[model samples]
Target: MKDSQPELLHLDSDEMTGYPNSPLPVLIYRQVLDTSNAEERADSFEAMFKRHGWPPAWRYHLYDFDHFHSTAHEALGIFRGQARARLGGPHGQETVLKAGDVLVLPAGVGHASVEADDDFCMVGAYPPGQEPEIERGDPAQLAAAQSRVATVALPENAPVGGPLAALWE
Candidate 1:
């Protein structure tokens, strides 16, 4: 968390690069904010987006509803929780509604989740390549309706032992 750390990130804009052919956005598993007050959440979310280029024009949300967050990719979480997603399948094939579940949606993949309760919070991720078309129920539905979506294309200098570690190497 040092301010002196290098903040600049460079990436190849073409698919001809050697990086993994990522079709969907990399879904990140971030914890819920411990603080109350919408301002704190807004501020924290703002910082994350700014530091990682999750544009203000992009669709992001802190949903105060009961819902499931699913898309593609997998094993990009901190906690050990049960998650189910049928690779290259249609909607309803994915499931990850637990206390600490981190699911990622890869390119060309689609998913939807069922909320256990009527309250909670969630973040979303779309596909990569030529921007993805995503769909969610309510609260986070606006992001689903966008023309295209963008996500952080695993940085080259990111730390080891992360979800994108091997790819970085």
Candidate 2:
């Protein structure tokens, strides 16, 4: 781990469109892993997440379309390659994420991959007992989504430990 503070990003809800972004700020921990070896990098991230109570769930690319999960927060550890991702929604914020970076998204925060290298991949995990349900920005589902998001529990520890864990608190 980096032994440093992570970059914090706060995104407000997009009420007009009905995407209920979280009250918690997004956390970006940069250069926190050794991406030189793909298999080892993935193993390291999985171990770290599991050790911290967040279980490693999947290894894949970020979806190409905009979506949010109202039932659980997410922790994505970039293991290989790089990409430009949109956070919040289609018109939200754009950011670049490379291997060795860890981006933590609270429940209801919209995200999608805008562009990515062919080799880009990530390890995604969630807090114990939290399973993610995909939700596109649909106004009709807004009421139920908002209720689920509001009740989603806060994570006790960050996927990346050390100083980064304090961000969740």
Candidate 3:
């Protein structure tokens, strides 16, 4: 595992859209895990997230269509392959994610996979007691989604641990 600090990136919301992206920035932690062995890489992420209070919930690829979650924050650990994903909305920022990377997304932030390799895989998790509900970018649902997102509680621990947790505060 890498001990260096992670590179942080934030994607602010475009108010015109229904996606109520949070004030918290979209976190990107690069090479935080060892990806040489597939099974071990996955285990490390599960262990880290669970150890820090965000229990590992699923393993899969990101959705291809634009969507967001107003119910809880999400932590995704890329365990295999790589992909290009968009954030905020359809026209939002595009980024590449590879193995050993972790993405911490605040509630209501939009995300969609533009393209990914055949082997691409990720482990997703959320804060203890928090569950995710999918919300497509629909203007009609904006008000309700915003209301829910506003009331959603923050996680007590960062998924990756260390100083990176301070970004949420």
Candidate 4:
């Protein structure tokens, strides 16, 4: 059976304790993959990132608390199991992500895993030559983090689409 086009979800920011949430909307692409093998699915996600000019991907689970990447945007593809995640900030929306789901988070957008199954895993990647800096809602570094986020360049293509990621444009 042919799969349908994925849906796009744009989430706005809500002010956190001392950090300024991202101004860009968080993009969610549901069921981007269908493979059941964890390793195969992760490899597929990595291939997609490479094709879209994003590289240096890694495999891991998301941190369980609210955090943001100050320097680079991130793409997370769920390869196994499922989880409920909070996006935007402390007061952001809660969303469920299952295997095959993909989430593209713009710079400085907060995300946390509220709950997850034991088998949950994800493949994460960044745009070419971009290194991610972790910011854990630190009040002292709020200004610096916000500045970095503002200056971060938007990726030329969305991780899932080489040049046709309409939601990213």
lDDT of each: 0.31, 0.88, 0.85, 0.78
Candidate with more favorable, higher lDDT: 1 or 2: 2
Model 4 misplacement above 4 A: 1-13, 162-166
Model 2 lDDT per residue over 68-156, tens place: 99999999999999999999987789999999999999999999999999999999999998999988987777788889998988876
lDDT digits (tens) for residues 12-87 of candidate 4: 5443454556756677778888876888888888897788877846788878988888888898989999999988
Cα shift from native, residue 5, model 1 (Å): 20
Candidate 3 global TM-score: 0.92
**True lDDT of residue 141, candidate 3:** 76
Scored by lDDT, the top model is 2
For model 1 the local lDDT of residue 84 reads 37
User: Model 4 clash pairs?
Assistant: none
Model 2, residue 64: C-alpha shift (Å): 0.7
Pick by lDDT: 1 or 3, better one: 3
On a 0 to 1 TM-score scale, where does candidate 4 land against the true structure? 0.87
Error of 3 at 156 (Å): 1.8
Q: Per-residue lDDT of 16-135 in model 1, one digit per residue for the tens?
A: 211221343334333433344434544554444334433222323222222222222222221222233332222223344332333344432333333324333333322222233233
Candidate with more favorable, higher TM-score: 3 or 4: 3
